[model samples]
Target: MGQLQLEEELGKGNYGTVKRVLHKPTNVYMAMKEIRLELDEAKLNGIIMELDILHRAAAPEIVDFYGAFFIESCVYYCMEHMDAGSMDKLEAEGVPEDVLGRIAGAMVRGLKFLKDEMQIIHRDVKPTNVLVNTKGQVKLCDFGVSGQLEKSLAKTNIGCQSYMAPERIKGESTGNLGTYTVSSDVWSLGLAMIEMGLGHYPYPPETYANVFAQLTAIVHGDAPELPEERFSESARDFVSRCLHKLPGSRATYAQLLSHPYLVEDRNRDVDMVGWVKRALESRAEKQVQQQRERNQQVLEQQQQGYQP
Candidate 1:
């Protein structure tokens, strides 16, 4: 809009592109998500749903929503710009146990707020949806696929397939994907925690021959857990409570907050700001290295062409 100046593109996904922008009047930096409108009703509904949730979700652990506007065919909504970026980008070398516990606590509190206050379930609970800043605050974002709990269950199987729980995957395979409880999100949280702690997805699809094989493994194989060698007993126990194959046995948001791992985290001082700074520096270095490799490859190709 007239009051905002676009700075740079933050990220792009299937639905839209997010860009860094500055609000002229307020002189504040914000991340603006621009979703192009199409004739598809479902897509429009998703946009509307996200806006609705953003406007209503006012919690410390959730991203702060600014304002939204419609221009031409695109709908742009602004939110708090998390300078440090998402957790997925920072987990390359794996997160420390103390830092992980703090991050997990924020995520659980945010998800709990959505369910209890807004009557919504964050269908997509992954590292990428969790954002952090220099202030050491971790918040949840990207609620486009979030669903309303109907009779303690959400009937839709819409979310990142890789992060889907075993029971949810089984439901999809059998064509009996009627409904999944909130505990499904707990499974995702557990998986995401392991991924953050290990610096990669716990169930790497590359290990399997195909997508079906991977899904089958998730449905039938043992639930993944944090390695005992790397993480403490309390941390492992918290994750185990989340990765339970049976949804009924999984820990609730309240229980997760009360867990000894998180309880201990409350007393300990974790250096999230230092961690984020180092992670960003590492990411920048990796990008530079990748660019150098690409340039070298192009130069080699050029030399080969010249020889002929």
Candidate 2:
């Protein structure tokens, strides 16, 4: 159990406080999340399962778990230091529509990677669990509650109430009534994106239960209200598809990447491909300008020395 000097408290959650740490040997910055595993054998098994799932889900858009170790009754996990912070921080700053779409695109890509490539269900896909790097690229984190989908319709009681699918709330004994599957994660993702777009989680109700009730209504009733045509029709359509009550009817991850919203946004509007290309072009042009200046400096030096 190596102890690194904790500089400042980065954030807090149900598990415990995460702090900024300086790895004594490498002198590199990292976020150390201190969590306790005080569970019995069954519960401990669940934690191990989560770790296994995260280990196999090696995606760039998924936060890299550097290492994990235990020290005197507590377990700690080290991860990359996301200097830009979480999506919650971004929401606080009130991101613009273009930026929101970019975030959404990054999130979708990460989820798609998990679902299509790794065959894992995040279970939790809210903004609070999404980390943003300095480049504004979003990565999905927090696999503590995620698991593998056993069937098209699943019955489970894991996940935040606000983001839980309608089927998950039904009686467990009803068996398939809770037939929410990996697509439920997509639903949560859509809701989270909408929250990012609006700068709020869209539950104006008084209590947490009220928030659940509101979500239940939307899940069963009419679609949620829009933001005065703020989102593109394609984006809206993708969201609608994600929130569909029937798990089988929801679009898969591959379908989501090829979705008109993501396709058009990346090809024509603001998105990762366009942003990265522009950044590379800008960097190349700057390098060329610098080279020209350096060549001029060398020529001047040569001319100045020749007269002497």
Candidate 3:
């Protein structure tokens, strides 16, 4: 902790905040995740689990962990700083197919590594949790909600409800809890792919009257598919296998890796470096526009106050 210098905050969530940090000795930039300690046993367990996973998860598709230490009431862990930030921060114009395929391959390989090597389930797989860098590398992060698989099933329903699989939703609705399998995460991967390709969530709650209605639809309605007009046949087929109605029918990680879409992508060259640069530029422009709008609103409010 003493060797690290804190910089601007990267993001915040329910568990803690991630910040850009610098190691004084090495002069290397890193992302530091700071989690405040709580008295609850469950919260402590989660923190420990995340630390354990980060320490052991060493792969090209996963973020590189540095070191961790306890400072007062908080635990600070350092990881590789992804300069480009999360995929969710990109513009909503949608990612190019080639870039999308590359991103999908990286995510699938990362998840597969976690499952096969670490015996863990990501539990949360979304654009926000997937980070990218200027080097065009895509890696997974934020493992606070991740859990170890017990006999191929993780019996906890702790993840984003919007990305939950149909079977998981049904279990919650009927009060007949069922074990969560790796297939559930595969379903989430499919939904995330659609969001990245279309620039929005496939199942928008605004279309329904209420939250219950949305969940009902997810549990009983036909699974969403990629639009044929925009996506290739191989891409659509791959996603269809993932978004299968039944959990048992969803494609396994190994199967997905062997799919023609991924196989083709492995051989193709994608300009992810250019895409990431453009995405970051777009994000900066959007932030500037938002700031201008805020300033205008403030000026109008001041004028109204002076008019009296």
Instruction: Report the number of the highest-lDDT candidate.
Output: 1
- Per-residue alpha-carbon lDDT of model 1 for 1-308, expressed as tens digits? 99999999999865579999999999999999887665467766666776887798999999999878888788888999999899888899799899999999999999999999988778778998899998889999976443322112133322223778887777755666564668999999999999999999887867887777777777788998898999999999999999888889999999999999999999998998888888889999999999999999999999999994
lDDT of 2 by residue, 148-236 (tens): 32222232323233666666645232565346578778778777877777767665455436544665665576545336557667667
On TM-score, the leading prediction is 1
Better structure of 2 and 3 per TM-score:
3
Task: Give a tens-digit lDDT track for model 3, residues 110-209.
Answer: 9999999988788778898899999989999865443322112133323233788888767655665454679999999999999999888777877887
lDDT of 2 at 286: 69
Q: Better model by TM-score, 1 or 2? A: 1
Candidate 3 to truth, TM: 0.90
- lDDT rank order: 1, 3, 2
**Pairs in clash, predicted candidate 3:** none
* Cα lDDT, model 3, residue 157: 27
Residue 260 miss distance in model 2 (angstroms): 1.6
* Alpha-carbon lDDT of model 3: 0.83
Error of 2 at 103 (Å): 1.6
Q: Which residue pairs does candidate 2 place in steric collision? A: 154-179
Task: Assess every candidate by TM-score.
Answer: 0.91, 0.75, 0.90
> Candidate 2 lDDT (Cα, whole model)?
0.68
